[model samples]
Target chain A: MSGLRITTAAEGTTHRVVLTGELDHETAPELERTLARLPQAAGHRLVIDLSGLALCDSSGLTTFIVARERALAAGTGFELTAPPPPVSRMLRVTGLDRVLLARHPQDA
Target chain B: MSVAGHQVEEPEDREASFSALLEDSMEDLYDNAPCGYLSTLLDGEIAKVNATLLTWLGYRREDLVGRRSFADLLSVGGKLYHETHYAPMLRMHGEARELALDLVTADGHRLPVLVTATVKKNQDGDPLLVRITVFDARERRAYERELLRARREAERERERLQRLTSTLQRTLLPAELPEVLGLEIAAHYHAASSDQVGGDFYDVFPLDADRWGFFLGDVCGKGPQAAVLTSLTRYTLRAAAVHDTDPVAVLSTLNSVLRQRHDPGAPRFCTVVFGLLQPDGDDFAVSLASGGHPPPLVIRADGEVDVLTTPGGQLVGALPDAHFVATSARLTPGDVLVLYTDGLTEARRADGLMLGEDEERLPALAAGFAGTGARAVVDSLAEVLTAWADEPSDDTAILALGPRPPEAR
Candidate 1:
């Protein structure tokens, strides 16, 4: 039982993951399993929307890193966008915004 | 006691009739009772056994009455227990109550049972025979087995956790800091949880004849994965410092190494403050660089505290071409420079608010220990981390370095 919830949807050539609620040590594994099951094929893009994410800790950040690595290795494009204020602040603090959020979804 | 008003027949006639009834049922009751009963001679040879006892053991009465002893009916372990404890206790106390044992049946299957034995003696106090009762205990034995299994499982899990924690501690931390001339260094690590391993680490090592390198950092997570990241960060910084002494260059080298040796399984990122120290004139010159780490504090001799901030520094190993900035300061005699992990700044207050990285709380706390050496500053701050709250959410690491005062010299 974890506080985190994940939903996946496909629109056009993009596979989007929507995360809501807190992402901590206890709940990060749920996201990891969901990311692992994605078909990271070429000619597609993976985007995570974090507008409803209330909290994210160090373990959550690690999951994001692993997801990015996996999608890129499969020759698929990856990006994260629409992060809430607190999560955005954390990304800026850890300097991960440059690596993970280099492009906005609207721009794509 | 007789009831006179409720009497229906003459007292003598009623007594005679009741005696006749008891005589008729005595043998039948002994043979068919729910419990098994046996009578054995002084040497444990079976003298007489009830029909119930014969049926329970799947044996015929003639086969056991003269041939086998009471101990022969028991399993091997039960036989040993009967000799060592049951026999001795019965001999001393004239009775042994509720001794658990297993009985062997005709097919050699074990029948779990409880036995109570008593010595029957004559008027002169010499023992004539021993009477024994056996009760089935299969249900109780099954319950005990389940309890034993659960207890063993918990013990094994605890042992594994302790082994992992100790292994991480032994490999990730330095055994001792190198002694440097004219400089005093002190460090303390406070683990928030006893069983879990934290990601914080710090070390001070000599680079060459005239230069020294030191660092304190915190990896992103806790446990074995964090331990691997910490090991890589520490060794890379140490090797990079030997090749180049500039603080910014050393951090950039670490960033590149972390990016190149990418572990997609677990995140490899950390915040660190790496510093290079060298003697200049009567004081030591320090150049410190940050990889998105908390800035260090400079406590002057007169109780004035200043934060040495390296602005726009990115977290190492997370990005390509991560930027780092180095700040310089001079550590005069009696001045202390403090570097710590986020655990201290993020410590929660009683109202559930963080004591954030601001100019007020930490600097004010350090002002009280102005002009004190590195040991005093580190020891007192460590006490605060222990006493301020019940338990901090994260582990804290503190490192303080300063030169000896003029008076001491």
Candidate 2:
């Protein structure tokens, strides 16, 4: 129940990575490894849906920021969508929303 | 039941031989039973003891019978247990089974044994004598001792690890924050586990005669590797501040250092808030930059709390061109500026709800101690974090800076 599950679904050029369950010190590495393997080409768009994310701690947030960094370096479009209230607050408090949520098409 | 095929010729001879065999077997079984058997009178005097009991204790049967009581064969602790627990339980329950005790041997050595005693009563239910059985427990006692020794060794190793972890953790932090003439400074750090070092670190040091620099940050992972990163991050920040005191430039320098030094396979990154303090005539002028770190909160003297939110800042050391934004705040008298790592906000309440889940929780807490100086604010908040329902899951680091109140100055 406390474990994190990561699933990826691709529709055309947009790839959606859905994260579910708690994301803390123990589960952040799994997300990191999964994100590393995903295609971050210039034309590909990466969207991380946090609706199912029950919890996101420091390590989890760090992993997301690194994922964003990787996407940027590769010139791929990156944005986070559907952040749960708790995760949203975390990003807002840390002022990460400015960078990670800049292109939130749905939440915008 | 007689055997049909057996000879009926020697009935008298068979009866004689069977009687002799039964008598011989009965005596031999009693004298050399695997377990020792003894009977003691109501006064605890040994009336009879089997040959096995005498052989185990290296004594003759007559040596223990009638001359020495059963209590006389017990060690000091065994004698106490016999008189207190063993004797009383047998008297009330009529039997005591499998009581472990040490018995003294004839040669002044201790023999561990399991003793089971039953009171043999008369037909009228009157207590007559006690029949006791003894079994050797040498191997069992030795096994128990070995287990105890191994447990103690494990405990010692854990203690040694904790001590080493804490000592290394201390090196990553400043022993004391430099005392700015007009500003009061305080900081606190709480590690989640003592055995493994946490990744949180903070330091406050003087930059110039009238200026000071401070930073608090948390690395992604923990343990020995994290400690090494923490040490590197702390020194790099200090050295960078020396070259450029601007909050943005200082952090930008750190970002480059971390990205270049850390291995590609194991990328290391951290969330950091770096600030510079300078005296501005009765108040301290503070300019801080955030690299995806939680914004600092301000508590006014009037009991109002404000979050100094700086947007558009990315995590330091994670990317090649990470951006950091600087925000300015003036710490007037009775106004405190507090900076903290995510460990504080990520702390969960007893109900599994994180303290940061409610954005107003920390502001509300800070409002309670409005106008308090840096020391009091840091100490109070530290107390709250320490006594939280479950200790903060991660390492938490907090640093508070405030201008001295007029009355105290």
Task: Tell me the deviation in Å of residue B336 in model 1.
Answer: 2.2
Q: Compared with the true structure, what per-residue lDDT tens digits does model 2 show for residues B13-72?
A: 888888877746777798898988889998889999889888889998878788989999
**Which residue runs does candidate 2 get wrong by more than 4 Å?**
A1-20, A26-49, A59-81, A92-108, B1-35, B47-52, B120-128, B263-265, B386-393, B405-408
Q: Which portions of model 1 miss their true places by more than 4 Å?
A: A7-18, A36-54, A71-89, A101-108, B1-135, B138-164, B193-197, B302-304, B347-352, B357-360
Q: Which ten residues in a row have the lowest lDDT in candidate 2 chain B?
A: B1-10
- Candidate 2 has an lDDT of 0.86
> Positional deviation of B283 in candidate 2, in angstroms?
2.4
* Cα misplacement distance, residue B339 of candidate 2 (Å): 1.1
Q: What share of the true interface contacts does each candidate keep?
A: 0.51, 0.38
lDDT of 1 by residue, B40-105 (tens): 998899999998878878999999999999999999999999899999998999899999899999
Question: Cα lDDT of model 1 overall?
Answer: 0.86
Superposed Cα deviation of residue B176, candidate 2 (Å): 1.8
**Per-candidate DockQ vs. reference:** 0.29, 0.32
